[model samples]
Target: MRCETRLYNALNDRMRRSHGVAASQYEFLRYLRDHPDTRVGDLAAFFAIGVGATSKGMDRLEGRGLVRRVPDPADRRSSLLELTDTGTQLVHEADETFGAIGALIQTALDPARLHDAAQTLRQLLTALEHDRIGTPAG
Candidate 1:
């Protein structure tokens, strides 16, 4: 958890300095870039956040002209998200900044140790996804 917090803080600081966008905002933009026309409810589910919170974030993104919401064709009550040209450019910049940060971190670690660590983390994630651990007992 501490490691996760540290990484999140570092990414947030870098994103603010380089892109003028908060890390959370960048995340939302990135998702929109990849999944154009996605619904707010889908985003909320993907992020494990509430619909209200997701809507609020979308509001901020819309205010910045980074994202636009169109009435969903299939669901009139909800909107589909799409990234603007400026938002797409910002996502590219954010990707570069993230790559640089990743390279900086990689330089400080031994390749073999880093590979092992990555493998272990992947295993842990897979186990969690499969509900191999942390499920409440009946």
Candidate 2:
């Protein structure tokens, strides 16, 4: 917890300073860049957050002209999220900033240890998902 929080703080600060976007927001953008036409509930489920929180986050991004919510033809109550051109460009720049800051993590841990940690984390996440740790996004 201590190590992750410390690293997250540094990453967040640098991301905000360089891109006017928080690390959390950058993560959301990066995900959207890779997976377009995602719904808010889907994002909430993936991130293990509440649907309300996800919707609020989307609202902030939408207000920033970074993303837009399109009505889903298949689901009247659901909307698909997509990054705008500006959002795409911003994410591209932010990716560089993220990678540069992420070098510190690589420097701190050997590749083998890092790989082990990542695998452990993935296992933990899978366990949580199986157990349904958080409230459902609905």
The candidate that achieves the highest lDDT relative to the unseen native structure = 2
Which lDDT values do the candidates have, in the order given? Answer: 0.85, 0.91
Question: In candidate 1, what residue range of length 10 has the lowest lDDT sum?
Answer: 129-138
- Please give the clash total of every predicted structure, in order: 0, 0
lDDT of 2 by residue, 23-96 (tens): 99999999999997899887888888888999999999999999999999998888899999999999999998
- The residue ranges of model 1 lying beyond 4 angstroms of the native Cα positions read 129-138
- Encode model 1's per-residue lDDT on 1-138: one tens digit a residue: 997788788899999999999888998899998887798887876665777888899999899999998989998987899998999999998998878767866887889988988899989877775764553222
TM-score of every candidate relative to the true structure:
0.84, 0.91
lDDT of 1 at 15: 98
Off by over 4 Å in 2: 135-138
